[model samples]
Structure formats: structure tokens, C-alpha cells
Target: MEVTLLLEATENAFRIMEKARAHALGVLDTAVQFTGEQTRFMEEKRWQVLFAGAQRRKTRFQNFVGTALILFAFWMLLSGHFDPFHLTLGAICCIITAYLFHDLLFANVRVGDMRVVALRFLCYIPWLIQQIVLSNLHVASVVLRRKMPINPQIITFKTKLETDISSITLANSITLTPGTITMDIRDGVYYVHALDQKVADDLNAGEMEDRVAHIFMEADHLYVEDVLDAARIYDALRV
Candidate 1:
């Protein structure tokens, strides 16, 4: 009789413990879901605010001024003319160009900072060029081989870039690199045609993606306004 009573009590305790564990798991799932929804909502709200500002019809005078200066500099570089007559004509042309294409000028209000982005992008250019040279040499070696071991395949991957400009930059960089070409980009995904396993593996390794993301501040920025410094860390890691 005592054994039967103990068994019943133990079974009841086991059932209660199982029910408690299930209830705890349910609460945790609900908390996680809530956190995810909140994060998404915040992201959407931030994007909405940025887009609203971009859509405003007011003429951005800063864009006009910056564009005019760049045009003037390019004109001087091409013409090498600094006399009054030439300078006047160059200014006129710059003004006209700025008037017509001011909207296309670099404006990154969404980024909340432009100088950091620009500096990081400039640093990325040299790295990309170096990659191009290395890739070209590799492809040349493959071509020179008697067997011609060229195995082409399309590699597709998703990116975390928040803006179209970043995506376009990444696409162009891939196309510029030898042994690989950007086939297409749709909905934050990129399709690249790689000449061989080496090229495909390099893309899959995501060094370039991380570089572009860093340039755009897609990753965490523990040190503000120190993009070049951050790049140095990455460079060291790569080495």
C-alpha cells in the first residue's frame, strides 16, 4: 500500500515538472518573438524617416556646390588651362553641368555621415585593384597551363548592404576583378560567374563583401570617424 502511494505521488511530481518546463519554453519563445518584431519595427521606422527626407522636392544646394566644384576640378585636369578666359569658360561649364546633374551627386543623408564613408571607400579602391591584379595573374597561369583547367560556374549569395549604391559598388568591383563577373543582382542577392574553384572560393569567403560592408558602415562602428584605422585591422587580419 505504501509503495503504491509513493508511485502516485512521484508520477504527479513528474507531470508537474514537465508542465513547468513547457511553460518556461513557451515564455522564452514569446520573448524572442517580441524582440524580433521590435527590431524589425525599428529598422522599418528608420528607413521610412530617411526615405521621407530624400523624397523632399527642395533643391539641395550643398549637392549643387559640391558637384560644381568636382566638375571644375575635372575641367582643369583635362584642359590644363588657368588663364582668365579659360577659367571663365570652365566655371560656366561647371555651373551648367551642376545645374543639370546635381541630383546625381553623392548625397548620403541616410548614412548620417559622409566623410567616413568616402574615406573608407577610397581605401577600398586600392585593395580592390590589388585583388584584380592578383586575379588576373592567377587566370593567366590557368590559361598558360597545357590542360587549361578552367571550370566556370555561377555563384550566388545574399548581401547585407542597406542601400542600392553599396550594392552597385559591390557589383562593379566584382566585374572589375578578373576571373569573375557579376551576372546579376536582385533583392539583395548577387549572382557571379567565377572562372574556377579558386575564384568561387574567394567570393564565398566574403572578404570583399566585408570590405564593402565596412565602407558603408553596415558593420558595427565602435570607433567613429576612424575608417582607415578599422581598415588597417582588417588588412592585418588578411595578411
Candidate 2:
């Protein structure tokens, strides 16, 4: 009878141990799944944070000033109203527009010194105008010719321009020039329709791209140098 009782107790203890082991395994599995989910969430959050920081880094107060000036100038140029009441109204409208849409207007504004960027852009305008005139003359000559030399074709080229503003500027410049139109821009690739081979050749040469790149490159280099200098100064102070 005692041997029988001992066998029964041993069986019960073994069953209890098995149940406990199964429960422990379930708990571990749940913990591992929960940990994995949290890790993924954290990774996503980190990317969001990094994206936000980059966006912040690309914009500045100077962007607002630049946007306001451009808007006001455009308004004045269009309205051509110099009267006090009209001027006041235009100014108010420009301020409101600038306040509301400055970020969008200067979405890729350099975080560097605005004065240098403005000056460089101003210098680029005259050269762009010259190109437009030359293009216009070419297009006119083609149109007036007895036999049309028109050979319409679409050309696609990838650019290394890092800023949305620079890419957009290049696209607009292409559109402004005669015989070539910017059809679409995606993933740093430009789709352009050329009226003739000359336009295609000019675009393929990438002069406009180089000019736009120059506008931003010097400012970006200076900005990076400024940041590095600031960091060094801070470190020296700490020491």
C-alpha cells in the first residue's frame, strides 16, 4: 500500500512540474513578442525624429524674410498700384501670404546666410535671361525657315542637385527657355520635351544644372564650416 501511495504522489508531482514548465515557456514567448514589437516601434520613431530634425535644419527665419520680399515685389509688379490705400492693402496681403505660405515657398531654403544666396541667385538671373534670348532667336529662326527643322523628342536626365529648390529652379529655367519644356520631375530625374535637336543638346550639356548647383554649393559649404567651428568652440570652452 505504501509503495502504491508513493507512486501516485510521484506522478502528481511530475504532472505539476510539466504544467509549470509549459506556463513559463508561454510567458517567455509573450515577452519576446512584446519586446520585438516595441523595438520596431522605437525604430520607426527614430526615423520620424531624424526626418523632423532634417526638415528643421533646412529652413530658417531668413526664408520668411526672403519669401515676404519676393511676394511683395511680385504683388507690386502685378498690381502696379502705388497709391497709399492700395499700397497698404497690398502690403497687408503680402504679409498674410508670406505668413501662411513662406514655408512652402522656401521649402528647400538653405539654412546658411541668406544674403550670399540672394546675391548669387541675382547674378544667375542675367545669365539665364541671355540663354532665354538665344533660345528664342533659335526657335524663331526654325519657325521662319521654309522647311521646319522640328524633331520633337522627349529626353530624360538625372541630376545630382540635392535641394528641391535647386531642382525646381532648373526645371523652371528649362521651361522658360524656348524649344524645351519640363514635362515632369521625379526622383531627381527630369523629363523634358525638346522642340529640336539643339534644345536637346543644350540640356544634355547640363550648364543650367551646374549653375543651379553652384548657387547652393557655396552656401552649403559655408554653413557646414560654421557648424564645425561652433562645435570646436564649444568643446574648447568645456575644456
Candidate 3:
């Protein structure tokens, strides 16, 4: 009789432990599912806020910049430094340009990307630094040589820039370099006039392409700035 009683007690304990284990696992699974749902929800909300904020800030900045440009034109008009109509027209042009390239001349506006356009100019500051350093050395070599070793030539090269902005930026950067002046841009490729063989070599280096790519990267679009595509004439036309 006692043996049977003990067996019944042991069976009850085993059943209780199994039920406890299953309940704990169920609780853990529920917690994990809840955390995943919450994480996704938060991420979606964060991106929505970020995009909306950028739009608002961009619009406001454009308007403020536009107003400043227009005001400067007004100041020019008040100074009576020439044709008032021309001044007015110039101001209008400035406003239009600002609206077109909002980052350069205007602020906070939903107009076209002025930031990338601005970046092109900002990038020149560094390029100018390089130019100052390089041109001096280049000029010294020519001066020290008994006969001028400079072999000035104009060469054409194609770029891989997909957007008009990036292509323009790359062209401007080339021109800003002491030895390389961009004479023209055909389609997306640039025709560069080099002061010497060294200039031609630098143009061939593709370093400028990488820098321009970095500038475009700061702006928020891929389609307009990637100059690394193999198909672009810039990549194919290196002389």
C-alpha cells in the first residue's frame, strides 16, 4: 500500500515540473516577440521624423537665403551705382538662381539642391590649397630648367558623373587645379588644357574624381553624384 502511495507522489511531482518548465518558456517567447515589435515601430517613427525635419529645415533655409539675396540687390539699387532696372533684374536673377540652387544663394527652401552646388565651391577651397602648393613647385622647376621643359597641351577626357551637378563640379575642380583648366564639357566629358605633362598626369590620376565624389556624398542623393560608374565618359575618357 505504501509503495503505491509513494509512486503516486512521484508522478505528481514530475507532472508539476513539466508544467512549470513549459510556462517559463512561454513567458520568454512572449517577451522576445514584444521586443521585436517595439523595435521596428521605433525605427519607423525615427526615420519619418528625420525626413520631415529635413524638409522643413530646407524650406526655411531657402526662404531666408532668398530674402538676403533680394535685400542685397535692394541695397545695390539704393546705392544708385548704375541702371536701376538692371539692378532690379539682377536681383530677380539672383532670387531665381537661389531658388534654382537653394543652397548657394538661398536657405530653407524646397527648391533644387543648392547644397551640392555649394559643396562644389567649398571643395575648391581645399583644391586651391593643393594648387598653391603644387603650382609653386611646378613653377620653380620650369624656372630652374635651362630650357623650358613645359609641354602645354589640351586633352579631352570623359567622366563617369551621372548628374549634371556632379559633372559640373568635377569640371570646376579640374579648372581650379593650377595646371588643369577645363576648356569645355561635352556631354559629361571635359576637355582640359594642361600647362605641362605633369598636369596631364594629374588629370589622369583620377584623384579629383574621388574628391568630387566625396562632395556629392554629403548631399542626400545617389543618382546625381556618383562619378564612379564605369559607363560614364569621364571614366572612359582619361587622357
TM-scores for candidates 1 onward, in order: 0.66, 0.56, 0.44
Give lDDT tens digits, candidate 2, residues 1-239.
54345545655665675576567556655666767866656655665676566445434444556577778788889998899998899889988887888778766465666667778789889988998898889888998999989999999988777777778888999998869999998898899999988779977866676667667663243343443453444335435
lDDT of each: 0.75, 0.73, 0.64
Q: After superposition, how far is residue 165 of candidate 2 from its true place, in Å?
A: 1.3
Error of 2 at 93 (Å): 5.2
The TM-score, computed over Cα atoms with residue i paired to residue i, of candidate 1 is 0.66
Instruction: List residue ranges in candidate 2 displaced over 4 A.
Output: 1-99, 218-239
Task: Give the top-scoring candidate (lDDT).
Answer: 1
Query: How many residue pairs in model 3 have overlapping backbones?
Result: 16
lDDT of 2: 0.73
Give me the displacement of residue 197 in model 1, in angstroms: 1.9
Ranking by TM-score: 1, 2, 3
Error of 1 at 224 (Å): 10
- What is residue 75's positional error in candidate 2, in angstroms? 7.2
The per-prediction CA RMSD against the true structure, in angstroms, equals: 22.1, 23.0, 21.7
